[model samples]
Target: MDRHDQVLEVWREFIATGKISNEKILSPAIMNSWKRSRECGVDPYQKKVPVILKEHKLKNLLERNKDLIEICRPFIDNLYSFFRGTGFVAALADVDGYVIDVTGDKEVLEMTSRGSFVTGALWSEDVAGTNMIPIVLRENKPCQLRSTEHYCWSQHRMSGVGAPISNPAGQMLGVLVIFGPYEKANPHTLGMVVAATHAINNYFHVRRMLTESQISNKFQKTVIESIPEALIAVSNEGYIALANENARKRLSLPENITGKQIRDVIEPGNGNFLSIISSKNNIMDMEVQIIQDRKPKHYLLTCNPILDAEDNPTGKIIILIEIVRARTLVNRMIGAQAKFSFKDVAGNHPRALETISLAKRAARTLSNVLLLGESGTGKNIFAQAIHNESNRAKGPFVSINCAAIPRELIASELFGYSEGAFTGSKRGGNQGKFELSDGGTLCLDEIGEMPLDLQTTLLSVIEDKSIVRIGGREVVPVDVRIIATTNKNLKEEVKKGNFREDLYYRLNVFTIEMVPLREMKSDIALLARYFADKMSARFGDELIRIDDDVISILTNHSWPGNVRELQNVIERSISVSLTNVIAVDDLPPEIRKKPAAIERDVSLKAMERQLLLELMQSKLSKTEIARKLNVTRCTLYRKLKVYGIPYQ
Candidate 1:
């Protein structure tokens, strides 16, 4: 007989007599397993392997072995694909010899069901009586059992091969098994099973390393973003590797700048900036000038070499600080912050309160504001209040009076100056009102008095939100909110060619007309009391009370100097008054001499008529004049008819 028939005869003889007469007919491994099975009292006539895992226990087992099954599933499918329709079946089992997964030909699977060859069935040597799974688990190596070689009589018609799958540490995690009919058993099946286990082990290791790398990268990104200064990482070969948000914003860099050359992003200033990064030594407090937006910006740079385990350079860490930001910090410490908010503005007149409401609304936006009123109307107070009320309240509140600064120095004062810009320029340089007010508000007081030549530059700066210092080629960016105040009527100035029309329109985005004290005379008593209390505290005295006669005199006078004149009168009264109660006798002689009934109505009407006549003579259309006066066409027409002025 052939090898199969001879092995079958030997297996029956061993089972019947409990001994093998010719030991050479069967391998010593198979003989030994049969001897062990008998010693353990395994039933030679058993028909099926018992399903040891219950539903709940099987679920827990699957979950525990999920990674192993996942890694081995494709390999199992591939192995089955090569032997499909040949009566072959493929399955995976855990270290305990319980089948966890299975796949096979439909007909073969149906046939195997009679023997309980399914998932969750135990196949240990004593229970299953020497199947391939038990053999591989016991031997810890590739194993094949064919026909009668299986100790149990139930599996005499089956043949199978199995291999132990282990992790990189060489500990067996599970077993891969492939089996078919005894008649089709081939030695090559064992090789295929062994190869698949090796492949699964390698793939598992790769997946674990990738997961670790992703976690590490996330941690590094978090640390980089937390740093406030501009930070960049460059590879040893000079390619950009990483940059933080601050670096991207301060340098105006693109979101994805990695892999680009370092020189491409930062323009070299006084020295070669890339060379400093490439140097082997660490650097600190090195002043560097880098051109951005066509303007040179100064930075205090620091660099440190990043080395590998062997001390070889792998990359570098570079930190950059804007020098202007340091100067701004000092400026803020000295008194650049806004001290007044909307709560500080105290007025009770309807018109005055309405103006405050408008200023409060203006503060909520980034639009430029124009405060139009006479001098001493607390326009500066409203300016400061707006700055304090804005979202940029944390930044500086810088004010530059166009009328106060000399005409020749107005441009440099407004835009800033470069080092050695002119004969008397400061040694390093000076930041202009715009730069100093970065991330805050810049109050251009008396904007109408600004030079005509400089108005063009101002308009450009307002539009572009950038400026180049005097004699400087580089452009510096600023985030300043503009709040301009002026006593002159800008529309008349624009018509007379004194102010640029475009500049006027730009600054007039949100107009707040500060009411003259005479127009809001109802608030005079209230403002007088506020000023009295304020001045009294300044003089280190108790809150002063104003007399009824003093309030009456203050309310009747036409305050051409507006709220400022009222404040001065209250201060004078407080200083000279003998008692805490201010009296009419304590008032200034000029205000006291002024007549109460000044006939302001007739003069106001006359001025309105003159204004209408001039506007009518100008190039503006009726609609334009109506819009400029902030009135409807119907109202303008009625006013023109009342004055007997011509209108078509």
Candidate 2:
């Protein structure tokens, strides 16, 4: 029988007997769908196609499947172009089998719209009964439906081909359908729909990967930028691939240096950063120098290799830090920090209290400070205390002894010299104390001992706030607070032509006289106890106690070396003392003999009086009497005159 006659016979048999005896007259796919439609209680004589969603509901469904609809739009448009004259309408439906979008011949769309076969129409087997969209969605496969295959009579003249669109994981997302008249239907039409849906799925997979890559790159860039240290990433080929904001600023690099060779940017000389990329081994804390504005600055470099999935080196990451910052870190680790505040000065003697009050006031100003005191008085301690209490407390406190350095090299030591400025000069030159102490305090200990000529240069530096290196012409400005300590009387030296008068006056702007230890005798016991406690920690023992007799001896002896001498005596006593309590016997020989020395001075005075009295009685001449007394005539006459005896 002809195809129309066969379709008619199957329809009639299924309706009359509630089953189809002519199942062999149709394709297995179509027969199976027809049976499913019948089991779903769909009638072959039904006239109306079900509307799944209208207006607002349809808009909401389209919005929910927006990604699927967008991915299939372009592919569906191209498919429609190939079948433009074939009366086909390309439609996309959600996995629920509701038509979300349709595009095709205007006349064919108009006919489908009248039968509720357009957008928002339900085409599921249970709703519209046996259509390509519903059947493809149900079976999760491609399908072809001929005219008589549709269970509803209203769709008897229509043919549709559809395929379920799925993601990379093979989970169905939606269906792509192409519908036209039954006369134009072919197996190839279904193949075309299946191929188009595959292309759309590929687009979805690629787009998802691109999105994830973008998110990952953005997160990486943010992390790199947030780091405080300079960071650079170099490719295996030695070209810079990425640099953070800190790296760019530190290297003085342009906004974008990607793909530029590392040597062109950093000019690695001693660091050998490129070797790390090849060796794939990490190198840390390597000191490297880079020249900027014709002067070299030091930086510590750390390089770590970036490896690929195969465990082979792909690139290297570089971290850079200025040597100054590294030095600060080292200083902290070694306890070179300025830990003493004004509270640590430890004394209530009026002179000591007054000195502390003056120091605390000086700590608030930026003027130069001149600490005048005898040796061993706590000048260095006061210097550090002033620095810690100042606004620049966080900065470094660099101290250099003027008397310690040789006169010949003191000039270069105070003001750095340039490269090749002198023999034995560092390759990149060196930063002087002034530069090193920038934003901090520089204590010039024993400032009186500074040479006469260097004082003139120092005066100029103080006036100008800048220094020219001994061998170089570059003028480096420094922001350092000068705290000069001197044991000698600068005024006397200036008068004696041994010091520059102008420099002396300039440094004496804010003079703080550090009280001598002997004058503040009341503080001796307190300071002794303090030093004993400190030495105990170093000696790894319990705190040593000072006996009252030892304190009395310490107070009685002349501390010519000031507080420093007391500390030394205390430390010596602790070392020799067999017990934890320091006694008078543990005192140094000089301190132990002080009382005898005082008694001996009184006896010697009485002996001299008797000897001079006897010499006058013998009637010796002034010269003879002076010679007998082992003194000069002037000294002997002065002694006789002060004693109220005859000088003649």
Candidate 3:
């Protein structure tokens, strides 16, 4: 028979009835299926595809398994204990129906273990016969068999409850089977079993997704369970229900974690969000990055409501992902944490260093800070880093650029109006930046660009931290530290009567002026290396360094637009340069000078000596040059070198 006849025979073997040819046929590289059969490979079809997103960086994923397992033994015990003393036996079976753990009365356990039905037993569809454990494992659905439904005739006297176990990818982990007398079984018991199964799935999946892994039964059995961030799954009533590996280890959670309240885990000193968490269930998400009393860490939390079939919220599921690194702004750059820190400020400029020092000191206090710099000097970077270091670092850091914002909507955007405050005010009477930064820092960039009337309203916020929405009735008290930045000289604007002097004074309690790239040429090389590294990671290119001419042009050229101009040039150079090294000829037009001419006289004699010398020598670092020429480092490093002169 041809390939088509063989495929039809194989599929027909399953139904043993009507012809149901597939609409298409093909095989794949890694995995193939009945749908496509052109090539052959392993089959990995599944019911659902898991969502992939960012995960919290683990502190020590290596040691977590060991420490976490001991922590989880108690919680694991509770799951088995649910069926304990109920005369029912609970057994965890792998996807192949190989029982890993069998718990209950010893006699009942022994009774079920007989007939090749215990650990290592394979009762999958292709195995001994139809079995509840393997059925649930195959289907990923909850199932129960009443009297006479079981395949084995001898097992008719007992009923079985089984639920499928799943990994983070919605793949099967195993099956949880509760085998007991049929008479004692109730819908609540089945419901509880289903709930427990779902709870386990949620806990492992959330942790796995956050940690970016395929959390398996192996992780459960092995992980010493050293999860760093304190984790809890609450039921909206502020009741603490479930704690994952880290939370269990850190908090020493017991088997009775399901019925406990939030207060049970936190002593008064530990948790600051206790009041807010208890007041209501829904919070979009909360993140707190702290540097004091501990190393820098970003702790993120999201709360989702769990609903029943009727769509009524019965509880809340919370997951936590934390990132810790003082100099890594990987998350902040992508707005994962919505704030900047020292990690986000990557520069080596003398003035930038000075500004960073001042910002750090000012962050220690609650005073406002004014940052002055060109547009691309990364004022937002400084503002966010300051906020991240400040006392309110544990709260949100909200930013608004006055220059980019529309004039008429500035009021609504900053002070958030009610739903009907204006023609298109958000229906919910949205919370403004003030409300968003209630307990944190609010960075107002280009403060000098704010309109006159808005400046008056902003001055009120500085006087008394409060905001009145455009169409709202009452004043909302806001607790926030303000950080303002302006690329334009605020003094010039104030002189021109464009900016309010009162607001300027309020914001300029402490000031940091960012020197443009051209003025601070010292940091050019380091910034080049940094940008090269960043771009390489982004573009997957090995653009390691620039050539001598490229570096010389970079140093000699006047960057009218400052650091921003250099970045644009670098981007263009990388895209255009085909050579391994960058040449002055390849640099943007402004960098290179016209080649010097010696009157174009038939200068073959001079040119001959130049060509011969160039072939024999290469430029060196100042120290190297000094060593070669027997001159002082000072002499070799002068402007003569900048002009590419061959001085020996």
Q: What is the per-residue lDDT of model 3 for residues 535-627, given as tens digits with 9 covering 90 to 100?
A: 655655555468765676687776777777777777666544433345455566666553553223444334534543553266645566456
RMSD of each: 22.0, 23.4, 19.9
Clashes of each: 5, 0, 22
Best-to-worst ranking by TM-score: 2, 1, 3
> Candidate 1 at 492: error in angstroms?
0.9
Per residue, candidate 2 scores C-alpha lDDT tens digits across 376-439 of: 8889999999999999899888888999999998888788787788888776566677877777
Which is the winner by lDDT between candidate 1 and candidate 3? 1
Model 2 alpha-carbon drift over 4 Å, by segment: 1-229, 233-239, 249-257, 260-336, 537-540, 593-648
> Cα deviation of 566 in candidate 1 (Å)?
0.9
The candidate scoring highest on TM-score is: 2
Q: Which stretches of candidate 3 lie over 4 Å from their true place?
A: 1-340, 343-350, 594-648
Error of 1 at 597 (Å): 18
**Ordering by lDDT:** 1, 2, 3
Encode model 1's per-residue lDDT on 1-648: one tens digit a residue: 888788878888888888898899877778888998888888988887765688899899899998888888889899988999899899899898888898998888888877888878888887878788878887888888888888888888888998888876778898898988888888899899889987888887787788779988887898889887899999988789999999998787888889997777664452466666678878775656777776677787888888899998898989988876765775677687777777878888888889999999999998999999899988999999988888988788988889988999999988888878999877557778888888888899999999999999999998999999999887888888999999898999999999999999999999999888898878888889988888766766657888787788888899988888888888876665545677655678787632464323344446668888999999999989988876656657756876788996
